[model samples]
Target: MNYMDMYKRWLNFDEDTKNELLNLDEKEIKERFYKELEFGTGGLRGIIGAGTNRMNVYTVRKVTQGLANYIKNKGIENASVAIAYDSRKFSDRFAKEAALVLNANGIKTYMYKELRPTPMLSFAVRYLKTTAGIVITASHNPKEYNGYKVYWSDGGQITEEHAEGILKEISKVDYDDILTMDFEKAVDLGLFNYIDDEVETAYINLVKGLTVNKDIVEKAKNDLKIIYTPLHGTGNKPVRRVLEEIGYKNVYIVKEQENPDPNFSTVKYPNPEEHEVFKRAIEMAKELEADLIIGTDPDCDRVGVVVKNKEGEYIVLTGNQTGALLTHYILENLKTTGRMPKNPVVIKTIVTTEMARRIAKSYEVEVIDVLTGFKYIGEKIKEFEEKQSKDFVFGFEESYGYLSGTFVRDKDGVIASMLICEMAAFYKLKGMTLYEGLISLYEKYGYFKEDLKSITLEGIEGSQRIKEIMDMLRNNPPKEIAEIKVREVKDYLKGINDLPKSNVIQLVLDDDSIITARPSGTEPKIKFYFAARGKSYKDTEERLEKIKMEFLRLTI
Candidate 1:
């Protein structure tokens, strides 16, 4: 049936809900019921609205019921699930509704009483040995959006086979047939458990283990001036607590964004990648003359940093730059102190800069590239644990997500926050700013600048358009983006570089520039990842701009 038919069916409900659906405009209804919510590599994310397809209490219940059914079918009789939510609107309610749905299915449920980071949810799944986990977050989406990410016992997002099983279960359920029981009754029956301080303590202890130089932190504790913002999400308490516990003094929280506000009142977009989101924090940093400014996304899974340059202007560091600096800092510190792991391995996404790989190679640390999401990195970590061949040193993506320790399976902003503060502190003790440190890194390992351009495709046709673009690129691969020759191509979907077929095409230029074009699995957009390197910052900047302009011309 069409959206109109679905709208009519929805109107048959009780007065309030019927009115709510009726009040929505035609465009709203079309967008909501255009199609079923897809389970991408990142899980379900949609605009929160009233429909069988949107993210509402009913949809959340239906998805949870399907998950519960899938878990039961796997012969997990005494299965348990951990649940957590961020500061997004309806996140808490959606989490509780999901827990209750699982509870009604005779599964044990452990949910956080309040908002928490996405990584902590992953950690709780492994630490508590739960059968599965659910996190209510949309990552860095707008305020009107929300999401549900399902994770397996290994703490990574559900794999393809498991997700297919859950999808089948979801298909079997009728929207009106989703069963939900009373939350109070679920508690009384011993099926629902609200996690408390003990879990927090365990998580905090795990974070404390991520610290490398306690003595360095001790020496620079009082000298560091750091400003942090949670972006009105879930990082406030845990980030501050960890910093204080690590012996950092004068760490200032962005007062306006300290509390949890579902609307994220302080910023237009809650994403840390966007410089506008850090306007308030940056202002505060300038006033306080702080050494650095750090901000985390809604679920506290990604982090962004800003440090003062030599001209006294704060410059926002890209994810690639941040990862390189942090990785270099950690490994160099470890090596200097004679603590560097013998079999260290660093992980990054396929689209991340090759500069990171070169830097790791210089340190004799192996760099492994995975698909976009952090789960692939987590899977690699699991593989390393099983094979006992390599030690996981660090994992990062070009989108500002990084993980220092294996305590969390996903990208962790809290850990990133702690480490960033420590890095700033370490640099301050050496009488340098974070920006200077980054410059020095570039001078040592050739200057590298990466630019990412995303073309948003919305509604039903948007997905098809993105796929069509990918198909076009695959069919008629670009020989040269500008005047430079395309040397080789690496396709990730085909799981090979030049040896096999893949959806991704990386064009290598004569000047050593690389251009990668791929459709974003999580969002309805096609992203162009550009990486250019040179001997100096000026040379790198000029080449980067030239490459960017050439890419735009070719794509257009």
Candidate 2:
């Protein structure tokens, strides 16, 4: 339907929706109704409001109906969908609305009674033996945004084929055809059931079992001062619980950011990937002389780390740095314990630092590079489990997401947080900090530095400009960047290296520096990733600055 028709329909629906629509300015109306909210590779994520292009009860029901149809068509005899939501605005309502839609379509639904993280939803799907899972979250998006993510029975986000099938069903759905049962009626009829606490207990126990050095944690429990902040999201309870259960007694939670606040009042951005988000935690860490600091985003799937350097100043470790450190720590521990698998495998995204490859090779373990999303990493784990070909050791991306154990298929901040603490304790017992451990790695693996630059372009015209930039770069590929010779260009759209097709271009430079340009699948922006290697930290920093400037000039 057109914007006018949609607006007219809204006017007759309810008093509050009508009032919201009536108060919108012309530009706001156009932006809200120009297009339907898309179900991207991850799922539907958009601004939360009263419009076809936003996230609301109506949109949630429509997508759930599509998912219901797809699940029925798959011929699962008695299909069920597990549901969970984070602490975002309208998250609880949207979760219930989606469950009711599924229930109305004759599917069983299991939903969480309270806010939970994304990884827990993945675990729930597998634990409940449900056919699929749905999570209401916008991840680290701003307060105005919300989202819905779908996962399959294997405890991973839906793959490309499954996404296409669901999108086809969604295309056929109309507003009037979206079916939903009353929430109370669905529960009375046994079509909807709340998730029990046992599931959570089981999940926590699974995460706690992943500790590589329980002895080390117990030894440093009292002396290893640590600071953590959930950034007003779902990580507070679970992260702290796992750490405390594993014997970390001196954990300090950032008081202001502990509780769930939709506005995320303390920071400009809720994403832990940004160092600015750690402003409050840094202050607390300094006063406590904490050995380490950790923060997780809204959904608790990604985690960021901060540690004191030799100069006595706390420094935020880039995702790559933390990832590399974790990789080496896990592998080295497994080797020492004589538990390293015969064919151990480590996984990372293509854009992540190549230093992972070097670190994995030092242990004689294989490193596999996949596409950017954590779903691809989870998919690889599923494949390995099925084929029994390679043993999955560790997986991570450059976005502060990491996975160490197979208990949860997705990137898990719960487990990552626990392991980060244990890893810190292990080094602290040796009289060194995580920053020092990272410096030692750099000394061994040639100082490698990486930077990400994202250019945001909103609205219709802005999207077109982003496309123009991508097309220009593709058609007239540069032979050199910042006076460095381009060794090769890998266009993922054409299916390079036996990977799935995607709209990504990666340039390999002669000096082993790599640059990748890919549009954000979840947001309205295009990100450029620059990686540079040098003999010293100063040399790498200079090269990174030169490359970043060149990329910015081209984009402008």
lDDT for each residue of candidate 1 in 1-556, tens digit (9 for 90 to 100): 8978877887876677688888888988887776778875477998887887778887898889899989999998689999999999999999999998998889999999899999999999999999999999999988989999999999988877788899999889887777778988999999999987888889998898888788888898887888999999999999989988887788898889999898889888899999999888878888999899999998999999999999998999999989998898888888888988879999998788787888888889999887777888988899899999899999999999999888789999999988888888888888899999988888888899899999899877887887877776667777876677778766666766332233577777888898888876666788988999897889898888888898778674
lDDT of each structure?
0.87, 0.91
lDDT against true structure, model 2: 0.91
- Per-candidate TM equals 0.97, 0.99
Candidate 1 has its poorest 10 consecutive residues by lDDT at: 494-503
Give every collision pair in model 2: none
lDDT of the structure predicted as candidate 1: 0.87
Best by lDDT: 2
Go through the candidates in order and give the C-alpha RMSD of each one to the true structure.
1.8, 1.0
